[model samples]
Target chain A: MARCRALVRPALVEAVGRLHPWTGEMAAYALGWADPAGTPDPTGSEGKGVRQALALLGAEAVGADGAEAVPGAVAVELVHTFSLLHDDIMDADALRRQRPAVWKEYGTGPAVLAGDALLAQAVAVLAEAPGRHTGAAVRRLCGTLNDLVSGQAEDLRFEDRPWHGPGAVSPDQYRSMAEHKTGALLGCALALGAVLGGAPDRTVTALDRAGRHLGLAFQAVDDVLGIWGDPAVTGKPVHADLRRGKKTYPVLVALAGGGEVAHELVTLLSSGRPVDGEAAELVAALVEEAGGRAATRDEARRHLDAARRVLRETPLEPTAARRLDALFAHLLDRTW
Target chain B: MARCRALVRPALVEAVGRLHPWTGEMAAYALGWADPAGTPDPTGSEGKGVRQALALLGAEAVGADGAEAVPGAVAVELVHTFSLLHDDIMDADALRRQRPAVWKEYGTGPAVLAGDALLAQAVAVLAEAPGRHTGAAVRRLCGTLNDLVSGQAEDLRFEDRPWHGPGAVSPDQYRSMAEHKTGALLGCALALGAVLGGAPDRTVTALDRAGRHLGLAFQAVDDVLGIWGDPAVTGKPVHADLRRGKKTYPVLVALAGGGEVAHELVTLLSSGRPVDGEAAELVAALVEEAGGRAATRDEARRHLDAARRVLRETPLEPTAARRLDALFAHLLDRTW
Candidate 1:
């Protein structure tokens, strides 16, 4: 992961710098490479570079040098950051990575414009890529963007639906939204790298499938952490998702379980009063008693197992395949 | 103009419809092709289709059938609508074309997302154009987007600067912003059409220059209309620009003139009191008395003449050159 980040980070920075200077500066701040005044911040916290690593690994698995996939890696990262910027605005998140969010630091208008510019820059980067598969890569990237927008739209719409009634969002609906929101981009990262590396269509498709499953597992794990993880490590308040009345995986499972405890939980959450720490603790205990936590963990393991099976069947180079296996295991082995 | 609109509008509608359905519906409504419920409205209000006309005329000037440039025309129109959608949000304007703005009709979140989807769809449309120069076309389109964002940023920043101090935006600064915000996309429309029609590099460059001049003239005329045009015809409030304290071309010209009338106008505008009908009339009289209005009108004429000269010098078929001359004259001959 460190080696992949070392290869892709500079290229990503350079690509962002190529934007219009004002927009470039805003993007740099949003990406944690610079302070609000455009000064570089060497120690700024950054994301895990998971998508970049996936792109490079996907290329390497298909017998191409990882460096050749730098453009794809950079483009995906830009798109990811763009999503984060807009998502923070829509979700009204005040903090990110233990600092004020972009919309909070800069104004909302600038943050919105910065995110739009970043999306355009990402497409521009791919459109100008010196690769034989540039056209195919752009098409795939646009499709992924469409999926991301659809997923976000659905997520917003879901928030307005009744939490426990005929109009409630089903588990299937949640899964579909998750697939579009997270899985599509992850799949596109692998597919883009595979296409750039001259992989056959079948191999590219398999890689995309593996990536989708990996993304699902990753989101499932994140949902678990949202409920039960330590705030000291997670950088989020305990029962943060519950206090916000978010219909996360375990909460949804408990709601669907349909018992006295589930009914009480729904009434308590829907009452619109603040869920204090004690109430949050009681809800968490009820979710555990209903087997919601264990069921959610099982779902994550199922997807991770499916991802590993796909990797085992795919005809990747032996070293690349082993690295991918290790990476998936590391991603899924986070605390329950 | 009618012929060009006839050729491009359907393709434009089709391209927008190809976006994700929810986003597509919002975009359709924003483009005035549909209502909020996703039903088609054949008589819906539409823009003047100036950019679409430039694209088709550019192709015809290069001896290609206008239909061959339909994709370019549609792409440019999509980009144009995308800008309007975002600009309305940034400007906080509640009305567009005498109707409620997209952000007012739909919520801000959907409006922003729809605008974003439109931009991505525009690039996707260009990337899939069945032309040998599709790659170059997409690159040029992306560059134009960058310029547009920069122009918007400058426009917003200028609003925050002191109108009477050293930080005041100059006439030259206003011209640069107009060129980027308006001219860049118009030039790109012509350039994309020319490239798609297989025009030689020299012809493509000449067409781009003509389009830029035309765009500058268009914006100059628009500035005039913003202050003095008939509300019934223009579909905007009388003295709309002055009411908003916008740093339009004529306003900047007046500020730089440094006369008693200009200074009084500045004081009235900077006071931040609502510019009611009587106050707007006074400001308008002051602007005209200071020669700002006449100077702005002359600026429009200058660009119109420059665009005409470019058309005369470029080697086009005699018939096509005559058509281009008439088109430019018609565009600039709107009621003052």
Candidate 2:
């Protein structure tokens, strides 16, 4: 993980530098290279390098130097950054990493351009990479972007949906959205890394599946944190997703029971307003009491186990595969 | 032109069909595939088939069937559509093609996603093409997208600059923006089409230059139309560009002169309100008196001549080259 981070930051910087100066500044802020005031932050505030680590480990699993996967790693990270920038604009999210979001700091139009530039950069870096596999990798990444956009469309559409009845959000629907929104990019990262590493087709497919399962597990963990994790650790308002009326796994699972507690939980969440203060705590408690929290944990465990099973079955380089397993464990640390 | 349009429409519809359904609907509306209420529009409202015609003719210029260049043609056309959808959002323009812009009809977030999906599909179609040159084509298209974003960034920033100062938008800067925003994709269309048709690098580069020159000429013509063309012919309100305070060739050149007309022109334009009715007519007259109209026409002719010179110099197929010249004449028909 540390090694991939070291390889990633410099290469990522070079890739992003290819953008226009104005858009580059906004992108720098989005990727944690600068503060909201546009001053450089030497101590960068980037997310844990899960996508990059998975990419490098994917290359290593095919017995290639992880350095060979640098372009794919940079590409996936940029796509992730692109999604964050645009998602904030769509969601009207005011803060990112406790700083002003890109749209907030730079205005909506500039934020849109910044995101577009990053996505362009992502495709450019990979397409220009020297490899017979680069074309396939580019197609894979582009296809993932299609799925990611669809997932986001659904996520936004969910807000307009009722909290219960035939039109209500379901666990199955939430899982599919998670798979598309978060899992598709993560899956592409590992698969693209393997392709760049010159892995066999079967190995690439296996790694992609493994990464997707890991992505779903990671998303469930994130949903849990959004509601119950410590704000000091999560870097967000406590019960932030609940306050936003986000259709997360725990709350939906809790509501699916159709009992009195489920009915009461629905009433609170269906009010079409930001659930806050004492009401937020009660909402959380009701979700837990209705078994939403436990159901979510079980879903996480199920996906994580599936990922582990796939890894065990695949004939990857032992050391690299083990490292990947350790990395996933570190990401969703509660399971371990 | 008719043949290329025939080839382009169905191919474009097929390509756009690959997008997520919701986004696909908005893109369909943007591309003249459907009406605002999402009904199919058999009488399509698409733009002139300039880019598509250029791409197909490029292949034929390289001694291949025009049909061979379908993917590249489709890709460039989608990129153009993507830009229009996003540009309308940034400009806050309510109308496009006598109807609501994508953002107005579908809302901003979905509009953003719809544009993104088209871009992804653009790169995907090119990368997935069956040829040895597919990689180079993908890289070329992606690089063009980066430039397109930069061009858009500059255009938006120009709005914040003073009308006359060191920080003012220069003719040179406007030319650069026009190249990036408008020319890049057009250049890629011709260049990628030639590449896919198996042309040598030099030939590909020549077509790219021709397309860019043609783009500059086309933009100048469009700028003139924005201010002075018949609204019935242009399908837009009279003085639309002046009303919106857009930086265009004639207006910028008119403002460049240090004279009475320039001073009054600056005063009227710098007030930062939409110029309309009698005031708009006066601005038009002042621009004409300051030699802006003639200067713009001269600039367009200069670039068009350069494009012709390049085409004459290149060793392309005679039949295709003649056909391409005719297409150019038909497009910039006024001067011809």
Candidate 3:
């Protein structure tokens, strides 16, 4: 992951430099080049580097040097930054990566422009990539954007629905939204990496499929961690998703099966009573009692197992395939 | 123009449908397909159709059927809409095309998403175009976006600079900004159209060059109308730009000469006193007396003539060339 991130940083930095000076500074901050006070960070590192690692690993899997996929890595990361900036505004999120959100720090208008600048640069980087399949690559990335829009819209719609009963979001609906929202981007990264690595269409498609499985696994783990993970690891308060009344996977699973604990859980949640930290703990216990925690873990393992199987089945460079398997396992067991 | 707009509308509508329903609805309203209350417009006709016309006309100029450029035309138009939606948010403008601006009507968050939707669709349309030069075409549009970022950045920077001082925006800087802010889109329209229509590289470049000249002329005329054009025709209050302390072309020219009238105008402007309608009118008179109006007109005329000469010199379909000439002349004389 560090090696792949190292490969991505210089290219990412140069692409961001193309922005207007003020926006460049803001983009730098959002990407962790600068702090909230506009002071440049010496480390200049930001983000989980998941997509960048996936892209490089994907290229390596296809028997190409990871460096060959830099354009894809850079493009996807820029797009990722663009989406996060806009999403933070839409979500009214005050903090990102332990600092004020771009919109909160730079004002909404400039944040919007800064996001736009990153998105435009994303297109430029991919479109200008020196490859026979550059056009196809850009189109693939754009199709991911389409899925992103759909997922975000569906997520927003879910917010308006009741947490339980008639208008509740089904487990199927939640999964589909997660696939579109988060899965599509991970798939895009792998697919773009393979294509840029000169893999055949089938290879690219298979990698994309594996990536989507990982994406689902990733989200499922996050859902579990949101309720029960250590705050030191997740960087969020305990039961943060529950406190916000978020319709996460565990909660949905817990509610879908009707029993005494499920009934009590729904009542406590739907009571509209203020939920303090102790109440949140009780809700978590109730969900776990309803088999929510176990079910969510099983779902995550199911996806991770399926993704690992795909990696084994698909034709890939031997060493890279082993590394990818290990990487997927590491991600599944991620403490942070 | 109507024919070109007709060709674009169906495809444009279809492309917008690809977005999430919420964003799609907002985008429809932005493109004049829906009313503010979410009622769909019966006609579905919207926007100035200038970019669409330029694109199709560019194809005709390159000896191809205008239909060949539909993707390019639609792409550029989407980009134009994207820029306007974001610009309204940045400028905090309340009205657009005789209605509440998208940001004003839908709130900035949804507006930003809507704008982002259009831009992503713009890239998708061009990237998916069926042509040998699809990559180049998308690159051109993305490069135009780069120019747009630079232009908007400069425009915002100009706002922060003193009206008259060491950091004052010069006419040259203003022209450069206008070219990036506005001209880049026009050039992209023509270049993409010609490229997709199978024009040679030289022909595409020439058309892009001519389109940029028209862009400069377009901004110069808009600057003129911002101060002196009849508000009844322009749909703005008299001297609206002056009242807002905009450092427009005419004002820059007026102040550059440092004459007595210029002195009075600067004194009036720098007093930090609120400029009501009467004061704005006084400022306008002083600008006119200082030759600002004449100089601006001459600047516009110079660009128009240069564009006309380029059109004449370039190899193009004769009848299409004549029509383009007439179109350019009409634009130069537009009342709004």
- DockQ scores of the candidates: 0.65, 0.81, 0.73
State candidate 1's TM-score: 0.95
Candidate 1 residue-wise lDDT, B73-149, digit = tens: 98899999999988888889899877788989987777888888888888888888886778888888888888898
CAPRI rating of model 3: medium
Interface RMSD of 1: 1.3
Could you tell me which 10 consecutive residues in candidate 1 chain B have the lowest summed lDDT? B38-47
Q: Write the per-residue lDDT of candidate 3 for residues A1-336, one digit (tens) a residue.
A: 988888889998889887888888889899888886668887634787889888888999999989889999999898889989988998788888778899999888889899999999998998888868787789899999888777777887787788778899988999999998888999899999999899999999999988889999999999999999998878778898888888899999999998888889889988998655899999999899898899988889998998899999999999999998998898888762
Writing each residue's lDDT as its tens digit, candidate 2 over B212-290 gives 9888998999999999988888888889888888889899998887699999998988886678998899999999999
Chain B TM-score, one value per candidate, order as shown:
0.96, 0.96, 0.97
Docking class of 2: high
Error of model 1, residue B186, in angstroms = 1.5
Model 2 spans > 4 angstroms off: A271-274, A334-336, B271-274, B334-336
**Candidate 2 residue lDDT tens string, A44-73:** 586777899889999999899898899999
Name the top DockQ candidate: 2
lDDT of 1: 0.85
Q: What is the DockQ of candidate 3?
A: 0.73
